[model samples]
Target: MTSTARAAHPFITSHGLKAALADGEEIAVLDVRETGVYTHRHILFAASAPLWRLELLIDRLVPRRGTRIVLVDADETLAHQAAAKLVRLGWNQVSVLAGGTDAWAAEGFEIFSGTNVPSKAFGEIIEHRKHTPWIDADELQERVARGDKLVVVDSRTPEEFAQFSLPFAHSLPGAELVYRIQEIAPDPETLVVVNCAGRTRSIVGAQTLIDAGIPNRVVSLKDGTMAWLLAGRALAHGRHAALPEPGPATLATARDRAEVVARRAGVRLIDADELARFEAEAGERSLYRFDVRTEQEYVAGHLEGWRWVPGGQLVQATDEYVATRRSRIVLADWDGVRALTTAAWLAQLGGHEVFVHAPPALAPRVTGAEPVRVLPSRAAAPLVSPLQADALLNAGQAVAFDVDRRAAYERHHVAGARFAVPDRLQSFTAELPPTQTVLLVSPDGVLARIVAAELAARTHRDVRAIAGGTGAWAAAGLPTASGAEGVLTGDDDHWYSPYAHADHAARDAGFRAYLAWELGLVAQLEREGEVGIRLIPAA
Candidate 1:
């Protein structure tokens, strides 16, 4: 039983921390530093806990009682986030160490070093974002409402969409876009827009669409939904949700269309060897490379310098990746579906040096390395979990997630689940929580396996994927609510809201309202996840 959560105050700067200490309040200061730093020296009476442990041990470390907690992490966001989580876990009061250790030392605070150093993976996630470009809410909303004929696609997890999203955006997510573009976004003439929670997926999503060939234009929404909110733009409000994947038939059609689109858009093919030669020859040229998998996958392992980019953001971040529309690009996932789609988008953006397929996973880092396997792979199998279904949902440290069509995700999901679908798995460098092992939830582990491999390929984050996906959640007897959204099942469904309305429709459902509602849901779910709930399957 976790402790009752308390409200947290915005962190004080390094100087601010000294003032707090001088006040001598009976506060529990948490140091989220590498165990090494803690061991060498630390603020008097500061507890040493890593972020990873917090995500996993919150239930035990935070009892269902009352306590005041303070979090201190190197990155500014991490400490603030930790303080927020503490509040959720029933703390009476929570504060973040503003300057973390650096500030403490500046105030003549003592610190310690440990023989066994704490892992710096959590610290790394922050540094990675520095290299990323961000757009605020006002700027992004202006673009969305600019009526520039740009399409804004929400590349977040379906659950995230259910929480809230940008005004007039669609929940496309990252993993499944490659499989469902034709049904969700069949129009090839409109400018394409993409976004995610932050920089990683948005940049990666835009890049994905650019790489894949399409007749229309494509761009990424800088800084994603959060930026939009910060910019003070109004978000469309609604309580709708959906899955971000596609059915078999829809996937096939999208794949077929991708091949044709690439051909029409002039997407070229290159093996590892050719890619290497091209990179060598294209000196002084700026090129953007991305992986359209989940962040966790990229953290586990990935090609060096291959940015862990999600496919959904490809439409928004095209500007950041390629400069002046003359750069080279390469991409791949479990298959080349996302790569081709992104390639096409690049061409639509007026890029000439576009190559739409990716070499095998084991292909050498060099552009012109030996071929590991042929590409343009057949549809991959979805993933599944191994344990008893109900156990997966009810077990300690368990989290239920959605891994199907975008509509299914927006429609409903087991409570307290985090989404890391396949399409955006490649941006691990910029995404992914450094703490806690990952358990991927999907309809079945079928799609989960494809996403899992992508995470393993990108980062060293400890990773594990649940099979049986959301099916396992249902099987595990977890609570579920209905009315969530699913993808457009047929040609008649409105996959791209506000753009394509089928027979008998009013004003097209804009993407802005859809995204805002979804982002709200994600925030809500984070709060609701603290309580334990068990579901009885409908007999």
Candidate 2:
């Protein structure tokens, strides 16, 4: 348990919470449970903040100290623990939901069950209001077979696009399509098809192009690649077709068109000086500065202190980005198109004060920040080299515990090693072999140390991290084994995405369930009264 004292925080009953919602107060109700548990059932508008990750995520979730926060759990333990942590982190107006989610259910209030519910619901809402046009897989396949002049744009992350997509689909992920479409499809008469692994991105991407008044006849690939697979079509895997850089003429046109759409959506523009002033006051208000650009572009160069969130995914998963309800957001991009277009949609869709920040000259190109290896300032666990670990394993003196995702561990892990989910290690340690020395390994050394520290505290055994983690081990020509040999806990922190499921039956079921959940959100939003989304009709 955290050593922080439980502060004098009020516990609001479900009835009181309902009243607060009805009264239009600025509040964020968070369910402090694992993603799997939260996805099964959680209060509507309650974002997931799993207890294990509460500390790492709380800053992003409740950035504002004064925002009214209500923590909910199946039991009061997680809620109380989370509240104590939040209070220790200097969050004010923190409270716990009395009697937890059960109390909310007992009060006859809604309890939604699903992952990415807000984004999925919003996509459905957009489709219902705008009636986004789409083409079925058979029609698209026939058109392609006939040598039709068209382009298929895949609106998923680069990694996801690489996994699987339509054969002809170019990796023009989400917001990038706004700026890159002109270069990819210069001919207005050409048919442009947008697709994702599933429906949401395709629907939103196609509609965005239409709304921006792109001359092409843009349409969504109905039900996306999942539908294609269901229709007995095979998707291409490991594809790398991507859009080229926009020329001067194409870039100019994109900026012009995007500005018009931004104006229509009432996206606010902030100059550098104004943004500086706004950022200076971050202590008093929650302000998220994001570079709404592709990861490659962001990696090549971006302004300081700005994180990259591809515009489309940011809007699609706003809750994942901004957890503090009603926080201000400032979006930046090299060209005005992507950021402005994203800001416009986010303004209406997120109900947040959104702004577009156009740097004078791309904010002076600099290498992006390195990925942080989260570790305590002072870590006591000794770091062991891969060679040392190998000798220890050969001698049967130490057991290696891989603290990584189950999928990663199954892909390639140290031979004869066991998998351990760091959060549940205490409950899982008993399953490990009887060894005094425990070797903790992660994809990188940073996470291994944290888990190593935790294991050290719990077992009172010699806990050491594999120096440089699996990467170093692999780099040293160490042999690895594939498949889940010894998994301590099920991979439940992330809800399974329908588009990525390998099993056809499971994928189909996920799609059906996702669509059903989405269809119900409009009524829920109306009753729950806090989504704050206003559907702007396409002109």
Candidate 3:
């Protein structure tokens, strides 16, 4: 269908969408609102794609332009806007929820709060079905104090582990648990504990080891680091204790174990010819090609068109990467362990057809980061260099606004620039003096440019974008400001994790609410009866 044709009949009723979801068709339901607004209430399976960043993230979130996409917003206004943008970006099968999420609620459908709902709920379901073993923070602390011969492995990304982690915890992100356990805990009699910030990764990580038939006794740290902090334990900050790569002997053993697990889980092993066939069917079906390796390894070399997402993170947050339900996924890695182990969990997660690329050799032709495909700005706005923007701001000739994520804005932005949510930019700028030229800034300037062009057309005022955004300003030795000064929208752009809260009371309350939400997911799934997860027994 053409873009214009889609625009004419671009709405699906809530009832129709619910039927479609249950019918097992390949579809991606996106909630086109900022993170904060999305976290308040959204459809159970919808991915978050704020209107402002639609073009920037559409390719990564939904690779196949022809995949059926249904967008939701508070009342369909923003969904309409996002739909128009997606059509321009070559997506044909796009529609908005007729009355938005409100309409869904009116129809007595389930509405979920929080990000990565599907993945977190799946984690809870896994623990319930598999009966994954776990140890609480208090008991683990006592064991540590008593000098128990056990190893603690953190299943979060290295960056998260470095921020704060439990005592004696070594970083071995989720996907790596099965592949590196032989080296991390060499003794068969030793105990192994896995943890993450919250529950999902920890449970998934521990289970991966058990399913692989590792010799050591493996258990997830119940409630993870959140429970530790709640139990009045201090996390070690700025720790860089990531484990070393497994030796060749260990890697071979891990590969053999992972192969058995993958076979038992029914994860398909594909070759070059099969992958080519999958690529050819991309127009008709959604296909995701992921190099399931560490970021450093991916940057060093990878398949030309494949994207990099660490194996552990991929299993923990599948919805974030694969937006289309029932799509085909291909995981690639040189070592058999990472790709095979990741595919094992994904296969058990159900919905999608999971496969591992069993390449003859690990050689890759491409180098550096995956290239990002961003839609061209609708119109080019006048641009000013960082130095020019600095002078203009200092001389009161132009008023500046930062359009980056709230967390990035709070970290450090161009001095004197007020933070503005892109969707609310026009209203925020209306309060400014008519004669002052508006300057917009973003992390990399792509979003700033896009917003500038739209704002210029709407407001008909002199609007311009900082050429390279705040990063450029800092690079030029210009002054910058930090903290939440001059924030117009105020914490309404992104959802804050409990750890993000500064107030001790609020943080504790947030954690309690979050844990309760996770714990209640299995019950919710039982009531709903359409989550589509299938638990496969380990061999």
What local distance difference test score does each model get?
0.49, 0.79, 0.87
Candidate whose lDDT is highest: 3
Model 2 agreement with the true structure over 322-438: per-residue lDDT tens digits: 776666899985787899888878887864688888888735766765243232422458999999999998898888888766777888888888886666666666665656578
Model 1 weakest lDDT span, ten residues long? 115-124
**Could you report the Cα RMSD, in angstroms, for every candidate shown?**
20.1, 3.3, 2.1
User: How many residue pairs clash in all the candidates, one count each?
Assistant: 155, 0, 1
If scored against the real structure, what TM-score would every candidate get?
A: 0.30, 0.90, 0.96
Q: With candidate 2 superimposed using the best TM-score fit, by how many Å does residue 266's alpha carbon deviate from the native?
A: 1.9
TM-score of 3: 0.96
Number of the predicted model whose TM-score against the real structure is largest: 3
**Which residue pairs show collisions in model 3?**
175-312
**Which of candidates 1 and 3 reaches a greater lDDT?**
3
Q: For model 3, how does the per-residue alpha-carbon lDDT over 414-467 read when each residue is reduced to its tens digit? A: 988889789999888898899999999998898898888878988999999999
Query: Candidate 2, residue 372: CA error in Å?
Result: 3.7
lDDT of 2 at 482: 81
Off by over 4 Å in 3: 1-7, 360-364
Off by over 4 Å in 1: 1-163, 166-170, 174-178, 181-244, 282-287, 296-301, 323-325, 361-539
lDDT of 1 at 422: 39
C-alpha lDDT of candidate 2 relative to the true structure: 0.79
TM match of model 1 to true structure? 0.30
Model 2, runs deviating above 4 Å: 1-10, 18-29, 61-68, 87-93, 362-365, 370-380, 431-435, 458-461, 498-503
